[model samples]
Target: MLIYAHRGASADFPELTMAAYEGAVEQGADGFECDLRITKDEVPILWHNASMLERAGNRGLIAEMTYKEVSRAYPQVLTLDTFLDYAIANKKGVLLETKHPVFSGNRVEELLVTALHEKKALAKIAVSVMSFSWLAVEKMRRLDSTINTTFLMHKNTPWFQARFSSSAAIGPGMNELRAEPMIAKKIQSLGRSLNVWTVDKDADIHLCQKLGVDILITNKPAHAREVLGYP
Candidate 1:
C-alpha cells in the first residue's frame, strides 16, 4: 500500500506548512496530502479550515481575504501553485482535498486545472483530487477526466456508489472502515481503489493491510512506514 503523509507529517510539524511537507519528504513518505481552499483573489491555497484564526491568529474567512492579505497575515500559508511546484520538483504524489463550502462556483476547479496545465506537472507526478462534495468531483472530472478523483466519505453519508461512478477511488475515514470492513471490499468490488484516511494506530494499519487498501493517509508517515516494514 502507498503511504501518504496526511497534511505532510502533520503530527511532527505544523499542518500544511512548507516545513511540514518538506519534513514528510525527508522522512521518506511516498506522497503527501493537503486540504485546499480558495482566497478572495481566486488563488487556491493549502488550508484545512475556512478561518485562519486558529493557525495564524487572524480573524477572517480565507475566502474574504486576497492572497496578498492572507500572505501578510500568515506567511506560513502555501499557495496551491507553490505546493504543486514543490510536489512536481520532488516527483511526489499528492492527494489534494478540496474543502467544501466553496464560495467561487467553478473558479477553484478552473484555477487548479490551469495551474496543472501551465506547469506541465500532470505527467511528472501523481495527483488526485478528493472532496466531500460530489459536485466538486464532477467538476474536476469535467475539467480533466485524466486527473483521478476520489469521493471522501464520513460516517453518516448516504449511498454514494452511483453518485461517484466516475471517481477513480474512494476515500473512507479510518473509523468508518473499522466499523464496516466489508465497505473496503464493496468499494473494490465496484472496481474502485480504496484510500483510507488519518490512520495512525498499529492495529488500524494492520487492518488496512488485511483489507488491501491501495493508499494509507496518515499524520505519522515515518512511524507508519516503520509499522508497514518499509525502509
Candidate 2:
C-alpha cells in the first residue's frame, strides 16, 4: 500500500496551491492527487469545482471564465500539463480526479491524457474520473489499459470483479469504507486497488492501512508518511 497526498500538502497551505504541491513532492509522497476542471474557455486547470471558483480567487464560475481571465486573476491556476511536468520530474506520482460530472464532452479525460501523453507520464499516473457514469473510465482504457483509471463511486456501492470488469480499480470515500467494510475485502479479493479520500488524521490513516487499502488520499501527506513509517 502507498500514501497519496491529496491536493498536495493541503492541510498546511491553501488547498490546490502550488506551495502545497511542491512541499508534498519535496516530502517524497508516493503521488499527489489533485482535482481537475476546465475553465469557461475549455482550458483544463487543476481545480475541483465544476461551477464554483471562489477558493480559486474569483467569484465567477470556472466554466464561465476563459483561461486568460482565470489565469490573470489566479496566478496559481495549476494546469494538468504543468502539474504532470512538475510531479513526474520530481519522481512523484499522481492520482488526478476529473471534476466534470454534469458536463457532457468528456473533456476532462481528453485534456488529462493529452497532457500525460505529451509528457510521457501516463504510465506513472492514475486518474480517477469521478462521474456516476463508469463508461468514462472504460473510455480511458480505449487509449491505454496500463494507464491507470479508476471509478470514483458516489452512491450505490457496486460489487467487484477483477478480470472481467473493464475498470482497473475503484475509489470510494472514507465514509463509504466505514459503512461497508466488505467493499474493501471485495476489492482486495478482486486483486484491484482501493483508494479512499480526504483523510488527514493519524488514527483514520492507521485504520485505513489496517483495512489493507492500496492507496490513502490524505491532506497531511508528510504527517501520514510519518505515521505510516514511510521514511
Candidate 3:
C-alpha cells in the first residue's frame, strides 16, 4: 500500500507549506496530498480553505486576490506549478485535491491540466486529481482521460453510482470507513482502489491496513511508515 502524506506531514509542520512537503519526503512517504484553489490571476495554488485568515493571517478570499497579492500577504503559499515541479524533481506521487464550489467555472481544472501537460510530468509521476464534485471529476476526464481521478466522499454516496463514473478510485473519509468497515471490500469488489483520508492515529493506520486500502492519506507519514514497517 502507498502511504501519502496528507498536506505533507502537516502534523509536524504547517499544512501545505514547502517545509511540510519536504518533511514528508524526508520521512520516506510514497507521495504527498494537497488541496488547491485558484487565485484571482487564475493560477492554481495550494490552500485548504476559502479564506486565508486562519492559515496565513491574510484577510481575504483566495479567489478575490491575485497570486502576487496573496503570495505577498503569505509568502509560504506554494503555487501548483511550484509544487508540481518539486514532486517531479523528487520522483514523488501527488494526490491533488481540487476544492469544491469553484467560482471560476472550469478554469481551475484547465490550469492544472495545462501545467502538468507543459512539464510533461504526467509520464514521470503518479498524479491524481480528486474532488467531492462529480462535475469536477467529469471535467478532469474531459480535459485528460489519461489523468487519474478519484471521487471523495464523507457521506454514504452509493458505490454503484460513483464506481461507474469516470473516477478510477474512491477516496472515503476515515470516519466513513469507521462507520462502515465493509465498504472497503465492496469498493475493492468493483475493482476500484480505496484511498482513505486524514488517517493519523495508530488504530486508524491498522484499520486501513486490515481493510487493504491502496493508499493511506495521513498527516503523520513518519508514524504511519513506522507502523507499516515501510522504509
The RMSD of every model to the true structure, in order and in angstroms, is 1.1, 2.6, 1.2
lDDT of 2 by residue, 1-231 (tens): 687888888888877778989888776678888888887667778887664446754577777788888788887778777888787777777777776464546776777677777787855554444433566676677755667766777546454323345666777788777777787887767777788886677777887989988888888878888888887
Candidate 3 regions off by >4 Å? 156-160
Can you give the TM-score per candidate against the true fold?
Answer: 0.97, 0.88, 0.97
Compared with the true structure, what per-residue lDDT tens digits does model 3 show for residues 28-124?
Answer: 8899999989999888999999988998787799999999999888999999989999999999999999998968977888889999999898899
Q: How well does candidate 3 match the true structure in TM-score terms? A: 0.97
| Ten-residue region with minimum lDDT total, candidate 1 | 156-165
**Regions of model 1 farther than 4 Å from truth:** 161-164
Cα-based lDDT at residue 103, candidate 1 = 73
Give the worst 10-residue stretch by lDDT in candidate 2.
Answer: 155-164
lDDT for 55 (candidate 2): 74
lDDT of each: 0.90, 0.73, 0.91
Q: Considering TM-score, which of the candidate structures 1 and 2 is the better prediction for this target?
A: 1
